[model samples]
Target: MKILVCISKVPDTTAKIAFKDNNTSYDTNGVQFIINPYDEWYALVRALEIKESQGGSVTVINVGGAENDPTIRKALAIGADDAVRVNTLASDALNTAQNIADYAKKEGFDMVFCGKETIDYNGSQVGGMIAALMDMPYISYASKMNIVESKATIERDIQGGKEVLEVEVPFVLSAAKGMAEARIPNMRGIMAARTKPLNVIEPSNTDYMTEIVGYELPPAKGECRFVDAENPEELIELLRNEAKII
Candidate 1:
């Protein structure tokens, strides 16, 4: 079972987000980057678990430039046997997915896994796109998966409950919470990752459907409005007029 786990580089959750170039680009200066939380904690870990049980390999893939190498190294440290960096500047979801799908198709991986969405972009499209590109079965928001023989049993989160799906090998799945527990890299793992194979590959020609014109932070919060607990009239008026709760 060769599992290809797609990881993403994202700003650390605590990083302060700001825009530059008249809000045309993110101001990465003074910001810390990390492996996307969902990818690191759920998707990659789940793939590692599957590999441990089935005795195979887990490879991490990312679409980014040199700036993302550190986070890619981190993923390798966590348990991925190797890493592949699609050398590109594209941050668009579609283009990224296309590049990954192209690589997966040629590599002939048995399973491809990705997080439900990257924390930074919050675009839940890659897994489905890859499945579409490969014309393979797709299971999004999968919280659990088990492989038996040549088939896979996947449990996905649906609107109100969960859905279990059985699909053949060579499929794509987007992992969400409950897939697996997060693992911090140990000293041996970290040291070994420094020398692990990190292949850099150029993305095949793929037309980008969109480009980011700019980025803007959400508006700052307004001054807090106090509610009078002893005065019922004030509370009602505030809710109806100011807060618009009614």
Candidate 2:
């Protein structure tokens, strides 16, 4: 079983987000980048778990320029056997997924794992796109997966309940919470990561279908108002008038 885990570099959760070029682009002046939490905590960890149990290799892939090397290295430190960095800017989800699909198709990986979405974009589209490009089955929001022989059994979230599925090998899955526990890199893993193979490849000729015209932050939150618990009528009046819920 050769598993490919798609990882992404995103701004740290605590980093202050800002825009540049008159709010047309993100400002990365002093931002700290890390592997996207969904990718690291669920997707990558689950891929590692599968490899460990199945006696195979887990390869991590990222789509970005040299600036994302540190984030890819961190995934390697987390226990991937190797890494691949697409030497291009991940302008949009479609382009990134196409590039990954191009590489994976050539390598003929048995399984591909990706997070449900990237924290920055939250476009939950890459895994399905890859599956389409590779002409394979796609399972989204997978919380658990078990492989026996050449068949895979997957569990995923659905409205009001969970759905279980079975598919053959060579499929794409978008991992969500409950997939696996997060793993922190120890000193030995970090040292080994420094010597791991990180292959850089040029992206395919796929262009983005859409582009960001501009960005604006959400409006600032309004001040809070407190209503006495004893004054139920006043609370109802406030809800009907100021809050406009009634």
C-alpha TM-scores of all predictions: 0.94, 0.95
The regions of model 2 sitting more than 4 angstroms off are 229-233
Cα lDDT of model 2 overall? 0.93
lDDT of 1 at 83: 96
Evaluate residue 106 in candidate 2 and report its C-alpha lDDT on the 0 to 100 scale: 92
Quote model 2's TM-score. Answer: 0.95
Model 1 CA lDDT for position 107: 87
Find the 10 residues in a row with the least total lDDT in model 1.
Answer: 223-232
lDDT of 1 by residue, 1-246 (tens): 999999989999999888888988889999999998888999999899988888989999999899889899999899899999999975677888899999988988999999999888899988899899999989999999899978999999999999998999999899999999989999999999999999999999467888888776778899887766787689788889877998
**Predicted structure 1, TM vs. truth:** 0.94
Q: Whole-model lDDT for model 1 versus the true structure?
A: 0.90
